[model samples]
Target: MAREQFDLIVFDWDGTLMDSTAHITRSIQAACQDLGLPVPADQAASYVIGLGLREALQMAAPTLDPADYPRLIERYRFHYFLKDQATELFAGVREMLQALRDDGYLLAVATGKSRVGLNRALDQTSLTSLFDGTRCADETFSKPHPAMLHELTRELGQGLARTVMIGDTTHDLQMARNAGTAAIGVTYGAHAASSLEALQPEFVAQNVAELSAWLREHA
Candidate 1:
């Protein structure tokens, strides 16, 4: 079915579409350990999943000096990429995206991932051509800020009122709110449903199946 209310469907990459929450959590912990900084608990590490790498690492390894940020970033990348090959899209994600595209929705990605990381993932997943546009944290403001959505909507020629941001973190929901757009949250990622509920998203999906159904019926 075609979408009536939303014209642009923007997605967050890590937890919303990709099954990389555990991998990301582990990688953050490992990066902190590599620099002898106190490792954040799983809850803390995962909580920063939708933020930009610099911001996420700063929160995850708060004890590190600013001068050592490059090293920390390098370590995070090293640990992250070691097993990034095993990361896969959540089940039904590809099909749902295809369905939305088939239904005339302008699909795009607004992620905290860097340009390099997102492009690599998109190529690896063979999903590059599926999107009409993309905005990366490195190229624009990170989540919880409206710049990414604002830029995406402008580039796609869509209005903020007719855009929806779907993601698995508070940052994502907050960004949608900041962008003056609607949001839908998925709990099968870094954050719990209770955590996401506070932001008042349009829908909260427990899994990709539920998300797909919601989008198909109501998006």
Candidate 2:
């Protein structure tokens, strides 16, 4: 058996587990079109995938006024839900998570999603009970802030040395670094593997299968 290097494994929700990046990007574009704002490019839209909705909207559509945020959010949500019904979890994600859980590792989620949005996504899959705890951007500080990781570790009673974050975006890696924990980057998500490499994650998995193999050995 491999030695246990970590006891708490924190994951990111959208791009990390669920393959919802393209849907989210398109939804953001649709919302911009609905409001007659110039649509952001796909890269611009995807770059904000791990941020709070309002922050993401502002970054993607910088021409919009703050007062227009409410309507923008509503339209974005409308468009997202329209396509979200078709989005699915990445292949082998559930099985990998279950394997880690079976190995006695506590799993948790730290995401930029709101509590409501995260719960809705989880309710759609068999992953509702897989996470031991969760922290949301809406309920706590947003990514790159470290608050989410801090809260998750505190709640789990897990020390920083025994905790590791798994995510697809630089924000996720930065959050883990800020919280003084290790991180593993996944390439099959929003950010490019090269970009994630700058953050110096302990490992970079190209897909769920690779991620699972790394975790089996290290976590």
Candidate 3:
């Protein structure tokens, strides 16, 4: 196969890089409990991992009143903060990102997290300098809208064809499709690899090591 030269690479947060899926799921559940609402099943909570927090909460608890959205979010933030400070990125993520950066690829993040949440994670990880750019769901449209990817490419002056989206959710792949860019799906995240394959990603990596290897040759 011919090597595809990509000028930019965008990553999704949460389950994509940070191993925060379980934390997010637990936070959502805790928030629901605090609101006296039915806690969403693990699968249900996991399903919304790549959506904006409002949307994720709504989807996970459809019966929740809009008036309660603020409280729900507050409760979520409470539980999230309790554990977020202890969270860490997935194994090999730092090494992979550093390798990609060393190879001269412009790295950016397009995540469903709010700007504050993303900034907090960046600061905690102290890996902020590794990324060239970033877009948060609260600052732009949520995943699968392509708005974040479009803005990132435009702002960075990278062509759609030469830009790649690497994520762990179908939302990420669909966003790449909407932005007319290539996508590489990572299986060890929120969504299943089977679901990712149905989206026809340019490549499907089972782990960070596999993803890094693929990028080493084709990115």
Model 3 vs. true fold: TM: 0.97
Give each prediction's root-mean-square deviation over alpha carbons. 0.7, 1.0, 1.7
State the lDDT of candidate 2 residue by residue for 7-89, as single tens digits. Answer: 89999998999999899999999999999999999988899989888888999999998999999999999999887769999
| Model 3 ranges off by over 4 Å | 1-3
Candidate 1: list runs displaced more than 4 Å.
Answer: none
Looking at candidate 2, the ten consecutive residues that score lowest on lDDT are 1-10
Order of models, best TM-score first: 1, 2, 3
**Which one wins on TM-score?**
1
Which prediction has the highest lDDT against the true structure? 1
Candidate 3: lDDT of 170? 90
Better candidate by lDDT, 1 or 3: 1
lDDT scores of the candidates, listed in order: 0.94, 0.91, 0.91
Residues 1-219 of candidate 1: C-alpha lDDT, one tens digit per residue: 657789999999999899999999999999989889898999999999989999999888888899999999999999999999999999999999998889989999999999999999999999999999999999988889999999999998999999999999999999999999999999999998998999999999999999989888888
Task: Give the Cα RMSD of candidate 1.
Answer: 0.7
Alpha-carbon runs more than 4 Å astray in model 2: 1-3
**What lDDT does candidate 3 reach at residue 90?**
91
